[model samples]
Target: MAVHRALAGICLLGLLLCLSSSPAARAASKPDYLILTLMWPGSYCASTQLTEKCCKPTNGEPAADFLVQALETYDSTTGKPVTGCSRSCDFKILPLVNMLDDLYTYYANLTCPSNSGMPHWKDVWCTYGTCSSLNQSLYFDRALRLREKVKPLVNLGSSGIIPHATKSYSLEDINDALVPRIGFSFTVVCTRNYILWPFFYDDYLSQIRVCVSSDGRSIIGCPNGRESNCGDTVKFPPVSYPVSSTVIELPSGDEMAL
Candidate 1:
């Protein structure tokens, strides 16, 4: 009987040790801030056929130039060479899920935050928060964590929420959010007009961007202005089917102010 008891105790100790040493055991339960800002029509691309200094939509400026300039924040420690980015006119292309996943992983692993020593536009800038902020990687990490947690929660491949290549994921397809803190606040531009969108079937222009709260609990639209319900609460179910693209704007002339 005493030997049996000792054997049971040893098994229990081993179990505890295994759990404590696992990554899931030490994983972050919640972080202070989480953010994700998605660009629209995917992002801009420059004309490959043009060599002239000036060109219209057919051979115009790239969109990445405008996006990088507007956001002014990126991972300073790590960056990749960006090409065909301008303001005049550019291609708006959406990357496949695999490509996007690579980017997210790379950003999450960066160690430095300084903008100096960067190559060309590869330098990362800070917008709402500084690059040297504590757990800057938290934002990126959280995105990864969320993706893992939400993967089994829903069916992303055939559910029609995002590209089929996305097997396991979390957060909206527009932006990836991960952080170490519990709560935070900041503003980001909404590049796409999901509520009032154009190019309904196009792959690049389908998503939109909006300010996200730090906790990853809720999201509100329309940050600025004096309307009573400026950032009112709204909800959208999982994209399980095809839906109409046009929005009702204002329900056939209501008395509400524009």
Candidate 2:
């Protein structure tokens, strides 16, 4: 009887070890989908209050178009973000040396105290990218590829939605421009320009959040459905800034305001 009990305990331990180390188990723990957030720099810098001071990259001017703000992971079943999946960040910039230019152009770190955008990349990789099935190189590469595929500015311009300081476009106008081109619905986020506050404020187009499949190949409707605080119309401001200008100093707020 004693021998049988000991053998049963060993079998249970082996089973647990096998389950914990299984590839299938690791894949199951990954997030169901990714949200590629493309932010409008003009609107991001226009706010009177900002959590991070905006600045141009030390390398050079970023592209005057929507930039990749974040590529976050979420669980469709729980409707919550999946973060801190791995303790081994082990991030190294050497692996990303080839794509540094594209990363600076599209996924820039405009935050104050501008340095190379390595810190921002590391944070994203440690927080969200580690949770993904992709390795570090593939993770950053995938985001860059997605940004190219979306082409937010080009699609919007094709539908007569060019940026203007004074012009405002309806939500429908923005949606029609992007959805058909991207072939999936996306959330258009807006922020109130508090720079002109106390007198008045304008809802400026901020970020566009699009859902991508786990494999990062095809676009899919956000499982949580469309989310927007935008009114009927929102201004599409031009991306104009002086070199090393003090763009914003908003009060403390959520990093992911979406």
**TM-score for each of the candidates:** 0.26, 0.79
Candidate 1: tens digits of C-alpha lDDT, residues 40-119? 21222211112312111111122211112211222212321111222222111121123333232222211123211112
Q: Alpha carbon lDDT of residue 114, candidate 1?
A: 22
The lDDT per prediction is: 0.27, 0.79
lDDT of 2 by residue, 29-111 (tens): 55989989899998877766757467776654477788887788888887777876775667777677688777877888778
Candidate 1, superposed: residue stretches over 4 Å from native: 1-35, 38-125, 131-134, 146-156, 160-203, 206-211, 215-258
RMSD in Å for all candidates: 23.4, 8.5
Estimate the lDDT of model 1: 0.27
The candidate that achieves the highest TM-score relative to the unseen native structure: 2
Best by lDDT: 2
